[model samples]
Target: MKTIPVQLKSKDYDILIGRGLRAQIGTEVAKVWSKRKIALVSDKNVAELYLKEVHQSLEDAGFDVLDLVVPAGESSKSLAQMGDLVQQMADAGFTRADGVLALGGGVVGDLAGFTAASYMRGIAFIQVATSLTAQVDSSVGGKTAVNLKEVKNIIGAFYQPDLVLVDPDFLDTLSDRDLVEGYGEVVKTSVLHGQDFFALTGKIKSVQDIREQAEELSIHSIRYKAKIVMADEKESGQRQFLNFGHTFGHAIELLSHGSLRHGEAVSIGMVMISQRFEAVGITEKGLTDEIAQRLAAVGLPIDSDLVGTPLFFKHIVNDKKNRGGILNLVAVKNVGEPVIVAKALDDMHDFV
Candidate 1:
């Protein structure tokens, strides 16, 4: 087992990563959180496979488990679904003393975490990350939110989890596409960390490689994020590095209208922004090709035809990074070096 501690001033927590950690969920959770009644939130797809095992584990640990399953997809992260979940928890007699346990992927984690953060003001939240995306990225970060029609993760909170269990065991059942989709964030982290991780990520060629190296790669991404989160918990300054590919990535995602996965979108965004920035001399020459080559090596695309979508500009301006009139864009100078470049929202159309 590998333990990485995220030492926030008030909400410090540990992220436990290992192969068989899923089976030890209940026991592991009991060590940090003492809540008696907990809501086990999952999606329909995941519930059919590992829900019973996880639920049984929680029950064995003396938890009054409330199994809350929702539809599985990006759509689940919505105001309607969040309201329904809050009402259900209220109907179940939940209190601030209780907690929430997210059992599926990012959707479940985001929804459950947000619900826990808002339930009677706040409650403990734990993450049992199932997907590679969740385990490697979303599971470790305290950022939680649902979508707002066109915008993604627009309404959310920075609520840290009490504990996060990232067991590679749960990754066994993911589809090939689902697994590869996660490499987008991996590639993003690699670029942010510089040469060491950049070279390491380039070695991942298949799901077999990812499975074999999950623990190591997960730790790399978590440590990078945890360090940045601890320094700039509310994204005042230093934390913007984490949004390296996300400005255009999120815009591309909104424009695709769910056609592309989040990671895929980010992959294209990373390369696109790098390509455009490198052309303008903001990013180092050859950096775009390097990023594109690594992403393509792992089967992630570096470009998308949706870049021409008329709604593209609109989505870009709506991003959270666009504070006041300046868009805080993350651009690359070299491998492992990312810089934030502020651009006027009105002047964005010609930058592409």
Candidate 2:
């Protein structure tokens, strides 16, 4: 097991990366949260898989435990679901002193964290990520949100978790499609933190290879994101670097009407961004090709069906980083290097 510390402005937490850590949550986390009641929030899929063991562990620790299950998928991360979960917490007699245990993938973590942050002001959150995407990226950062009617994560907050418990063993139960879907995040993170690219790329020859490398790559991606989020806790400036492939990624998600997986859209978006970087002469020769080749090698689509650059650009403008009509576009100077460029929606004609 490897441990990484995430130091935020108001709180500091640790991300525990290994197999079978879920079973040890009681022993490992009891000291830090001995007094607070534990609210176990997970999706129906995960609740079926491991919720009982998780619930028993917390109960055995003598902490008041409330287990709440939500539907699985992106739709679960919404204001309506958030409202329902908060009511569940309230019905369970939760207090501000209590903390939330997000026990599933990214969607669960985002919605649970959002609920914890908004309920009675705010509370601590613990991430027990069961999906590769959540464990590697979304579960580590303080960025918590529920999707709005017209946008992805349109309504959200920055509430750091108290601890992140990653159990790689969960990957064993993940469908091949979900595992493949998460590889997109791994590849995106690897591109930004290039030192791991070779190792990450070599671990998988095809989509079928995801299971073997999912755990290691997930840890690597989380550590990469942690380095950036820790440096800029509030996203005041530099943390935007973590949005390297997210600008177009979010747009793709929006354009697909939620049909696309977050990482799938991100994989396609990264390719488009790389191409745009090359077209603008911001990228080194052949680097864009390498990006596409690597993504394709793992079954992620490099080309997008989102034609009509103007329409796609419209969705880009809807990003959270857009301030005063300027979208903070995360582009790459090279594989593993991220630079933020502030551009108006109209200025994206050539790129999008």
| Best-matching candidate per TM-score | 1
- Tell me model 2's lDDT, rounded to 2 decimals: 0.82
Give each model's whole-structure lDDT: 0.88, 0.82
Q: Write the residue-wise lDDT of candidate 1 on 1-352 in tens digits.
A: 9889999887789999999998899999889878489899999999999999999999998899999999999999999999999999999999999999999888899999999999999999999999989988998879899999988888999999999999888888998789888878888999999799989987887767887887888889988988888888889897898888788788888888888899999999998888889989988898888888877876887898777566888888778888998999898788877788989987887887
Q: Against the correct fold, how does model 2 do in TM-score?
A: 0.95
lDDT of 2 at 305: 74
Per-candidate TM-score against the hidden true structure: 0.98, 0.95
Winning model by lDDT: 1
Cα lDDT of model 2 by residue, 1-352, tens digit:
8899988668788988988788888777786786668889999999999999999888888777888999888889889999998888888888888989999988999999999899999977888889888878889878899988768898989998888888878988898667777778877777778855645665577865777666778777877789988888878777887777778888887788867888888888878887877787887778767767777887777777784456677777678888988888777787677788778766777546
Model 1's lDDT to the true fold? 0.88
For model 2, state the Cα shift of residue 206 in Å.
2.5
lDDT of 2 at 202: 52
